[model samples]
Target: MLWPYQVKTVPSLPEDAVRLDVVEQRIVPPEEDVVLIAHRQRIVRGLRALFAAGVAALGLLVTIQVVMIVEDRSRVQPGLVMMAIFWLVALVVGYDAAKGMLKPLPRGKWSELVAVPASGLATLGCRIQWPDGRWSDALLSKVDPALAANVFGTQRLWIVGEAFRGATTFAGVPGHAVLGRVRFN
Candidate 1:
C-alpha cells in the first residue's frame, strides 16, 4: 500500500540550510489496512456531533429561559443571567470542538530527527524539525517497545497530511510507517 504525498520546500529556509536526499518518496504502509487511522477518524466525528448537539440544546434552553424572564418581570433577572453564562460556556466549548474538526492540520515536512533519551517506557518522544525551524514533538507508537527503543536519528521520514485524524505525528519513516497520535494541545 504505497501512499502518494506532495513534497515542497519552504521558501523561508535557505537552500543550503538542510539537505534532504529524497524530497518525495512512496510511503509503504506497515499493514494492508491501518485500523487505528479509521478508529481515530470515527472518534473525531463522534465528538463533533456530540458537541454540536450540546450547543443546540443549550441554545434552545437559554432562549426559552430568557423569554420567560422577560414576560414575567419585564427585566433581566439573576436567574436569566446565570442561564446566559451557562449558555456562553457551552457555546465556547462547542466552538472549540467544531473548530478542531474543521481546521486542517498544518502540513508537516520532515527536516531532522533528534535522538530520544533513554526512558523505560513503551512510547518515546520523537522531535521533528521543519524546514522553517519549527519543531514538533511526537510520541513514537510501536507495536514492539524494543523497536521503538532502537530508532535512531539516521532514519528517514516523509510528511503526509490527512493520513490519520487526531494524529499529531504526520511524518512517515521506515519500519514505523505511522507514528502515534501527535499532541497539539
Candidate 2:
C-alpha cells in the first residue's frame, strides 16, 4: 500500500540494521565480472558529470548577473533581486545534486511481487517491494507493454535511494539497467 511519492516515516525494524559495508561485502563478490562493475561505475560517473554541469551553468549565470549589476548602478535594484533569487535556487539545486553524488548505492533484495496498473494514457503504475519490508509505487511512461508484463518479479534490481529516488535497474546484468520513463508518483 506504499505510494511512491508519499514521504512516510519508516519505523525502525527491531532486527539489527543492515550495514552498507556488510551488504556490499555480501553482494559484490571479489571475482565478480569486472565489466559489469565498470559499467555501473560509468553510469555513476555520468550522473555526477551531469550534476556538475548543472551546477556550473548556474554558477556562470550568477557570475554574469553579478558583472551586469556591477557595470550598471542604475539598474542595480532589479538585478540585485534577480541575483539573490538565482543564487538561492542555485545553492539549493547544487546542494541536492551534491548529496545525490555522494550517496552510495545500497544493495537490497527486490520483492518477488510486482503490481502494474494502468493509470492514464501512456502511463502505468507500478509497485515493487523490497525484502526489508520497504515498498515503492511509481508511475512509469513510454514503457513497452510486453517488457512491463514480463519484468515483474523477474530480476534483482539495484536501487539508488531508499524511496527509489535516483534509478532502479536490474543488477548483475548489462543492457537491463535502464527502465523507461520512471517517475515517483
Candidate 3:
C-alpha cells in the first residue's frame, strides 16, 4: 500500500476503461461576479477621470482669464482674449468628454479578503501579483512607479489596475465580493 500522498486510484470500468476526472477546485459564485465588478469599476473610473479633468481645466481657464484681464494687454482686446480662452476651454472640455466616454471604468472597493475571496490562487488576464498586500488600480497600461509614489495616488490607482487587482484579490464591488477564491482551469 502506498501513502495517501503517493497513492493514485483508477476508477473501475470496462476493458477499455474511461477514467473519471474530478475537479479539486471550482469557481464560487462571487468569482463569477468578477466580470460584472470589472465592468462597473471601469465605468466609475472613467467618470471620475472626466470630472477631474473638467474641474482642473476650468480652474486653469478661469485663472488665465483673470490674469489676462488684470495684466496690461497690447494688441489683443480683452474680449477677444477672453473669447480665445473660452474657445481653448471648449476644445479641452470636448476632448476630455470624448476621452472620458471612450475610457472604461473598472470596479473597486476597500475590504478584507474575508469580504471577498480570502486566499486562493487566481489567474490574471496577465500575470500580476500583490507583493505587499497593496496594489494600485490605474488606467495606465504600464504600471508606473511614479503613480504609486503617494498614498493618495496609490489609493486612486486607475480602473484597469483596480479591476485586475480586484479580480485577483477580491477588493471590489461595494457589498459583494467579486470572488471568493479563484481556481485556474
TM-score per candidate, in order? 0.42, 0.43, 0.27
Best by TM-score: 2
Q: After superposition, how far is residue 26 of candidate 3 from its true place, in Å?
A: 12
Error of 2 at 173 (Å): 7.2
Against the true structure, what is every candidate's RMSD?
A: 15.5, 16.2, 18.2
**Tens-place lDDT digits, model 3, residues 1-185:** 11246666777656986788996753333324555456546656776686677667767766776676678554335665576577667767766545533443333333322112112123222222344564333222221223222112233222222233434222233223222222111
lDDT of 1 by residue, 102-157 (tens): 44434433333443333324555555454455655555443133334345535323
lDDT against the true structure, each candidate: 0.50, 0.49, 0.40
Ranking by TM-score: 2, 1, 3
Candidate 3: list runs displaced more than 4 Å.
1-32, 73-185
Candidate 2, residues 1-185, lDDT tens digits: the string is 11257576877855876655543323333124354445456667876787677667667766766777789866555754676577668767766645532444344432233444445424556665645666677665655443354444353323332444455433222223332334553
The lowest-lDDT stretch of 10 consecutive residues in candidate 3 is 112-121
lDDT of 3: 0.40
Candidate 1 lDDT at 163 equals: 27
How many angstroms is residue 20 displaced in model 3 relative to the true structure, after the best TM-score fit? Answer: 8.9
Q: Which stretches of candidate 1 lie over 4 Å from their true place?
A: 1-37, 74-77, 104-185
Q: Give the higher-TM-score candidate: 2 or 3.
A: 2
Deviation from native of the Cα of residue 64 in model 1, angstroms:
2.6
Clashes of 1: 1
